[model samples]
Target: MDHTAYIAILSVAFLVLLQHLLGLANRNGKNKSRMRRPPTPPGAIPFLGHLHLIKKPFHATLSRLAERHGPVFFLRLGSRDAVVVTSAALARECFTEHDVAFANRALLPSQRLVTFDGAALGTASYGPHWRDLRRIAVVQLLSARRVGCMSGAVCAEVRAMVRRLHRATTTAGGAVTVELKRRLFELSLSVLMEAIARTKAERPESDADTDMSVEAQEFKQVIDEVFPYVSSVLWDYLPVLRWFDVFGVRNKILAAVSKRDAFLRRLIDAERQRLDDGDHSEKKSMISVLLTLQKLEPEVYTDTMIAAFCSVRDSFVAQAEIDAAVGHSRLINADDLPRLGYLRCIVAETLRLYPAAPLLLPHESSTDCNVGGYDVPRGTALLVNVYAIHRDPAMWEDPGRFLPERFEGGGRAEGLFMAPFGMGRRKCPGEALALQAVGVALGSLIQCFHWGRVGGVEVDMGEGSGLTMPKAVPLEALCSPRAVMQDVLQKL
Candidate 1:
């Protein structure tokens, strides 16, 4: 080798080494500048941190902590540092101003197992991948037009529920006492499955049907087992415990995820077969749309992504609204949703009181940022306590009381603090479909039946422990066909 070439190579290597050192120094200096973290509660233990302080119905526990530490407080949950935002102002800061910074999801062990390592829409991190999923959801699968097309399926399933209820009442020779949680869950699941896979038989027959396909039954059973444990699992917060499989939490998650993945794969394969059969019908399911997109962009839309795409109650001032607006002349349909303003209010109020996910799905900060004038470090998990914010005395008048009329005059105002379906970029794309389904189902039930509390007792409004924050005691009510809607009920 020539002496000149050797010297040139050495110079290049020296320059690269110098640049690497400089980058490290810069990062170290940045870390040293340590901005003030949010105020943490007083009772953090040594290794457990605030884990010991956490109790069941976590949102309420956090709300009590926020009262002492202020709206935004920090907590060290095992190895992870979490920021809980309990007030509207702080929530807006995290979701609106610092939305992108907090766009990534906290990668819990259970979430990774279920979401295929964050390939699914709800669990994906904040980046091009998440944006792509969101775009596909909003523009293609869950667009207003697409949801409107699927409205028929939603209505049909809701009617099926009503018919089943009617038969139960008739069989009992009057109003029958029935548990509502399972029925409502079945209706919601059926609508979702039909819209995604074009499959109606997947819906559970009676919440205890041995005749159902093993895969279908397993899928439902896995969901029931997995959701309640997502946040409650100790190993997720303390990784070391996973080694021992303490409480068998890790094994349970794995078993449930295995079943779930297998079921989803079957759905995808069936959808692919349908597509291969040259049946390009107009009323395509969400999976079909995703499959078509997968063909064009195979790298971006993988089979796991296709598999991931497949995935409420209210009461009485609603009945008056239905009677006056919809009347008993004919059954309420999707077109009538616009005119049923008060019905919408009731649904909104229900959400405010009981958001599907009380913590609004754990979000992780991508970069150091300020929330409520306090520094939040990168990699800190953010739990926007929408449940706390919704029921904050400062935000809502008589926060515990149900007041659908508060939302009557106008919809949610700009920066007015309501985020039942979440807010900003990561807000749930299924909001429209959810509201529409709930509105239709609730409206139909109220219109067709006169619901009463069993044994003349007020319905137990206690919340259950789970990701979705369901009613602790499943709602059991006396449902009788309304005299006014007898003609409509008879036709069904």
Candidate 2:
């Protein structure tokens, strides 16, 4: 070949190689650029932003994130935006300082249909109507006086539960695998119902006694399958879904809601009939109080309004279902109240560990503000993870241990940091009733039985999803009569 021809061929070959190398460099450069972007927090894998974190239990994922990202961090799950708060200081800010600003609940799709246009106090927006309804709820249903008056019911139910436990133990060869969660739920339910029903005698154990394993399992299944899905309905945020109602998800919820609403209507109707017939007295129930308000102030509050306000429909009654299925012991009646300190501690601990509203009602910033040094603009959705805060090591001495003594006297639970009921103006009005019910129940349980785990492994204190963090495994315990050693309990 001629020298010029050789040089031309060589030049063409060089150009081709150079182009290939440059293309490779650009591709590699793009890959490196992507890698350089801070790996989206811990627990996230390629192409999925924090999806793996949610697959595991919620508490574990949150605990892991808290460890890596300090107390607070931003997260996204399938296009949903969230900020997790894990410290008491931040929780305090969300609960108190930011109370009014964050009072409005982030509208949940499931409750929107069921809550009578968001009229229920728990899900309602912060407004004049909300304030008025809350006022009535606190004064009428959840007031200290109302809860205190229900002490007799608490005593009655606890005694009944003890009697049932005694019967089960005697019947089952002295060792019964009694479901503590359901029993406790029923106890709480009985008191709440009796308080609402104003019933004097102990409520009858249902034909399908909630204590039985089959009924307990069914109750749990209904809650577990139905609740979480309903709460996170895809349509709430996505407007496009509204036109077609999106994927038939709304229909399923509506069906479930209809069934639930029917159950509540029956309960309410029965209560109303008693009032109409003059069978109810000054010892009126919370429902009756609501009915009275509706009658007296027909303009502001009507029967439907009262029903929406205080009715133990699926939204509220499901809590009782969950409480029963989860196996906390029943609420103690008045006679056993003195000795059931541990039950109170358990309720406190449960609230701490598995906050009913872990993130709490999402608060919208009314105006631009700086919280924890980050600029939070108005219209931002604020979430405070009470679960993370309760278990914070800095705030708590031994956060994970189910130690109730920390709250015993002038201790960690007695001050600013301890608020399971939330704080400030938008605080939960049901605080008084929950405390009274939980305390009396716990006291009675301790007084009546010697509670210990059934499987012998430490009670699996693992938590599950819900409005409340319930025991992953309902508490199954062997209840032995405490009356034999009543003298010792009396001393305490």
Candidate 3:
């Protein structure tokens, strides 16, 4: 090589080394001024940082990482910084002490389109707008009194499920293999439809109940297709990819949004027509109630705002209430759910073992805050691993065992953190409605059917990768109508 060329290369290399040294010194100075951050897991690569470590079924992967790191650990995921809380105490601290500081949701390129630009209550930024939506939902829709009024809808849906299952068995002249997840989803959809649009199966065996209606199918398809994209998209994490639409994610998402909006508009327009016709009914469906509110406050309760509630999506997988209090002579109803202790225990245990959302939606810190004695800088994402906390051996005795009896005496054992729906400001507001629906749906199934594992083999409890951690294999079970409830089902 020429002497002059060699010298030029050396000069550039020396300058690069000097800049790297200065960067290190700046970081050291910042560390001295700020409190220590939680320890980070090793093997973080450039650009991606710890993104490579995040495997499918995020909560489980993070739980394993926590075992190796600690209950509270930091992760640099692509461009974002995140803190995972696997311990109850630390999680409680984050919610109670630093609640407001960590109330904002981490901004995502996909959520903007998916949630109508943070208009949906679940993904809305913590502020007056979110507060208003929460209030309207709580007061007019999910309030105790409102949920009670909605009990009839829950009962109607559960009865439809029972009747459908019974017909399936008779078709085969014996217990038939059934997909419980499909049945559960159908029942949930019918109930929600009735609430949102007063739409129900014209007949007990109609497509809406036996099979998902096209509307329900489209709705479910949109959620299953888009939500996972919203939560875990490389486009959201990497600005370069997001800018160029490298993966064409934007087009796919818009297609889903168009389908979803078309569905919501149908529901809204139907209710609007009913109102215009002057058919004032005593039992107003949720959409009807919102339209009523819109008349009072048009600005706050616009069609777009009402559509947001219809699109919450958090309530998509929600249900329970029934048995001893009502007895077999009469069917169990929503009014009976509160007194059914053992049923409540069973529901609690189910949620504990398999929470709907194992990892609660991530929270973002709006400003610098101290969590578990470590400084979490502004914009740091907070993930509370409710799954690990629920199953922690230190927190619960024999946590792995399926023990409904543990929740029987009194209520949850004192101070044990068992948050299936989550905690703090962002706790799922559908808890009241979901618990009632599940109690009735589950109790009705148990009352009207004899269920068993398919082929007498243990169920494969392996979970699939997704937002809700669905079963790897859909639940297949043998079921037949109970002899005692045959007459009652026949009447339906």
Model 3: residues >4 Å from true position, as ranges?
Answer: 1-33, 201-214, 311-324
What ranking emerges by lDDT with the best candidate at the front? 1, 3, 2
Tens digits of per-residue lDDT for model 2, 106-196: 6666678777768888777889988888888877777777776767666666566666776676567566788877787766656655675
Candidate 1 weakest ten by summed lDDT = 207-216
| lDDT digits (tens) for residues 1-492 of candidate 3 | 999999999999999999999999899678746678898899999889999888888999999999998999999888888999999899889889988988888867788887889889988999999899889887888898888888998898788778778777877898999998988988898788787878653343453337445566667777776775676678677667877876778898988888888889998998989998996787788889999889999998999998889901111111122333565665678877777777777788889889988988889999999887888888889989999999999988899887777886765856667788777888788899899999988777776777777889988899998878799999998887777777888787
CA RMSD of each candidate after superposition: 6.8, 12.7, 6.1
User: 408, model 3: CA deviation in Å?
Assistant: 1.0
Best-fitting candidate, scored by TM-score: 3
